[model samples]
Target chain A: MECKLIRPADLDEALAAREQYTHDALPIAGGQSLLVMMRNRLVAPAALIDLEPIEALRGVEVSSAGISIGAMNTCRQLIASPVLGEEVGVLPVAARQVSSTAVRNLGTIGGNVCHNEPGADLPPALLALNARAAVRRRANAREVPLAEFFTGYFETVLEPDEILCRIDIEHPPAGAAGVYLKHAISPEDLAMVGVAAVVVPDGKQTGGVAEVRIGIGGAAPVPLRAARTEAALKGAVLDAETARAAGETAATEVDPPSDPHAGADYRRKMVSVFVRRALLQAARQIEENGHGAA
Target chain B: MALLELKVNGQEVRVEAPDTALLLDVLRERLALTGAKRGCETSHCGCCTVRVDGMAVHSCVVLAVRCEGKAIATVEGCGDGMELDRLQRLFLEHGAVQCGYCGPGMLMAAQALLEQNPAPTLDEVKKGLDGNLCRCTGYTPIFDAILAYGRGE
Candidate 1:
């Protein structure tokens, strides 16, 4: 069967096409992974709604509340975005590490989040930043937190009739530092275990963190926050011992899958190692820069 | 079928292809410009790498219809008609080609990188060509070629 291409001029037309096609169509953002999936015979949609023509789905905007990132902004755009570099620096850092240069040239943040592929680099960083997905239908819209976005492997909470318009992220707390660490055999391969840590220091107590958020990927069925680990480290002074304990606790929070790249036990072990490294590095970054600006 | 108006090698040409046809298929099959090789259709291999609007992208995963108005540059566009370009000459001098399967893609990827960064470090050169793999030369010669080109040698 020949698949059809539907190019909509605006968001309204896109939503209407999405509503009209529903399950028979799939929205292609960047087509980085979707086209490969189509070639592999994993998905065969009757129509592909091209989101490239919709101007509303393209740019990065900043308001008093936070940053609004359009769904169509490619990874290259994210890397070159000075606003993202100043506000959420970890996104550009992660964006640089997405895939090869060619793939990152066209791959997008919204597509990465919606694809929900295990071992992807964006989710952990986005999750740690507490990003929210802005989704729209024909006549309505809603926001889904990054934490609750992924349902399972290669799956998200996105409905057939809805299109993810943008991602919204509030500014990180003052004096907070974020770090993303990926454990992949090669630079281009997906991480065996990817860890992102955002640490906010306590102004009143020296060496103590007021709060800590840890987002992990490729370690479970879905990218998730280590809530138990976060709770354990809240208000605690960060040290080698404390970071080690936090890493151990995070390891207990996930059930990693075994595959050709790694065994379940190996991946579980890497989670602990990388989590500790990421947390310590983030702390060191704060010490060096006097803030989480990096 | 869709009628695509493309600017390839700075030439305005019209080609009719399937709505969902890949840019690689259109260039290789219909237009007969086979400089971009079809390696792993999955995009892991950069054999199908091309420049869309001056950005390096794997043509195998790009839809032909999507590239309608974009400037597409393949290996065929790298040099003057009858003579080898500087980068191609450097590749030969550096002995970068072994089996030559990855030659065109490497040239395209290298050309794109050089255009972006007139002078790229060895690490930057490696990262720029990370998507391409050459089972033959172990990449040392390719790296040497790009570095030499950056040095204006």
Candidate 2:
């Protein structure tokens, strides 16, 4: 299909394209994903609403609340944002591990999640922290919990006319410690199994477990919540034994998908391995690093 | 069709092409900057590496429209005549290049590494060039070339 390139300078111009062209128009932020898909013939639209001209969509703002990462912010930007990095180093650490320098410079964090690749690094990390995804539909804007944003494999709940304006990560929750671990088959391909674990300590705990959130992907169709693992460890004291149990629970709970990249067994096994490593990693980070989001 | 005005090497050229135009296409077809070759139309091969605003990116995967309002540097722009850039000269001196098809992309990738980290360790150099594939297995000299040039040692 023939397509036209449309550059939108403001929210009004972007919304105008949405109202008039609808599905034919897609908001292009960074163009790293859309351009590649278009080139590969996997995705084609009749028109593109390039968002880079909208300066409002470019800067990274850190506040007392958390980090508000703009839609057009590239991985390069995130890697260089000292404020965000110090507040949330997990983001840049994950961004740098995504692919390579060339790809990282072009790929945007918004595009990474917005594309909703099941094996993507940010989704699991974002979900692990319960990051809120802010979507703009015309004149209205709403924040959707990350868990609800993804509906299925290669699918998102985002309306065709709406665009993900930015991703609002809540200030590292008190005692929040996070890490992203994945089984990468190669430097270029997506994860065979990715696990992100964030531990939000339940302070004043007398006996057992600190609160923890574990998110695992590439094993399942959508990046999934490790509810069983979270349940097993919650209110229970975290020890080597408890961490081990949580890892096993995560592996057993998530229904891993099979593909050319990895078998179901491999993905499932990695669920146990990566989640455990991620948990321990997060635990160590909290203990050694002191409080997060200072 | 899309009308884009971009600075190729150092000169600004205006051209009308399809929205699907790759930076490689714009450089090779319209503005006559062909030093950046197109290897794999897909990004699997790094034959199309170029500097967009100073970081190396795959021109094959990059949209030409994105190049507008940004500085683009190709191997052709690095230096005049055969003098080449330091990395380029080092690559030849170290015998890093073989067959010469992947040379442009290799040089671009190496140049990016040196610019950001002039003293990358061997592992860092290896990590930096992970995206660029050299089919001839000429990596030893390539690694040596990058390390030597980056440190001026």
Candidate 3:
């Protein structure tokens, strides 16, 4: 049981408190998943350093550099933001598919990544978007690519004292189209298989893909980028045949575990199907949005 | 332990509770507001749903201390004495109540939905109430009641 709930007035105060109670206390934002764990006797910290009151780690920032999302920003906030809807619409689409309306109301993106649950909706989207995570401990701040942020299931490269401050994702080219496809057992269930794709056409070469990124979730120990699939799709003609081949390549990249909810083989098959669908949908979005689709 | 102050059902109240004390426990035991039931201590069941700053969240998983200075509303606050809110009246009129265990959470979910969206489509209402679960009524009556309430019927 947490004895003291420390509500720091600012980020500096929060960091100072975190330094003081590095091992004794746990920094809790939203307290959705952490509280559940506490109730189950999975974690019993001496104190809970509440991170909600820190203003610096809240809200969304859009600038020329791209979108810098503060760790405290809730899934609801992400879906409600107009700038995110216009620029990185796939993220909101993925956000909406998280647990439920009530959970989305309180769940934070930073907490989501920190919790690092398998089949989480945001990580795959973040990977496809080529986001960077800004982490801080004391006065030292470092930016880690989203691809390298997660080291294993329920693990990240973050040290105990380090806090994820913000996530930075580059704005896709004006006409770049992105899609997130998730397959879950039910509306409220964690995704059995999730795929995110972002496709940008080359301005110089006719019908050639300038950049293609594919991210998959629930098919491996950690959310992963479909590196082979991206390599196959990159510079290839943005067409149905190329998307199909990329999907096949994506299936080979993942090592899924057999579980009660879904078998490893079934997940691998869904990965190929979803990847193909996501690619086709993204390509269609590019055509509809008229983003250099020659 | 911390002295947490919150506005519940439009009344300002203070309670001494541990930092880890769940909002659901504080509400039911300390505050004596048992409208929010303890169905699944886990968030899977919305039997403990409440409004914190007008957003629907599972009170079971929320820390009572963390709700300080926020407007909290439970099923007890949904009605005034014996006078029912429009949605409550509609729920009865549409036969949405069954075993009645999930009534408070269902009503809270519905109220939160209608407050945000005055005229929600059936699909939208289903989406709004996705977090809540009801074993009885097959959910059709609840949906109909909420839809009827939205139509101002």
Q: Indicate the residue-level lDDT of B47 in model 2.
A: 85
Candidate 2 per-residue C-alpha lDDT over B100-148 given as tens digits, one digit per residue, 9 for 90 to 100: 8888988888888888898999999998887788888468989999889
Candidate 3, true inter-chain contacts retained: 0.91
Candidate 1 chain A, poorest ten consecutive residues by summed lDDT: A285-294
**Which residue pairs in model 1 clash with each other?**
none
Q: Which of 1 and 2 is the better model by lDDT?
A: 1
Q: Tell me how far the alpha carbon of residue A33 in candidate 3 is from the true structure, in angstroms, after superposition.
A: 1.0
State in Å the error of residue B84, model 1: 0.5
Mind giving the per-residue lDDT tens digits that candidate 1 earns over A64-87? 899999999999999999999998
Give me the displacement of residue A24 in model 1, in angstroms: 0.7
TM-score of candidate 2 on Cα atoms, chains taken together:
0.94
- Which model scores highest in TM-score? 1
The window of 10 residues in a row where model 2 chain A has the poorest summed lDDT is A201-210
Full candidate order by TM-score, most accurate first: 1, 3, 2
For candidate 2, give the DockQ: 0.62
* Candidate 3 residue lDDT tens string, A30-54: 7778888878888788888888888
- C-alpha displacement of A149 in model 3, angstroms? 0.6
Candidate order by decreasing DockQ: 1, 3, 2
Docking model 3 quality class: medium
TM-score of 1: 0.99
How does candidate 2 score on lDDT? 0.80
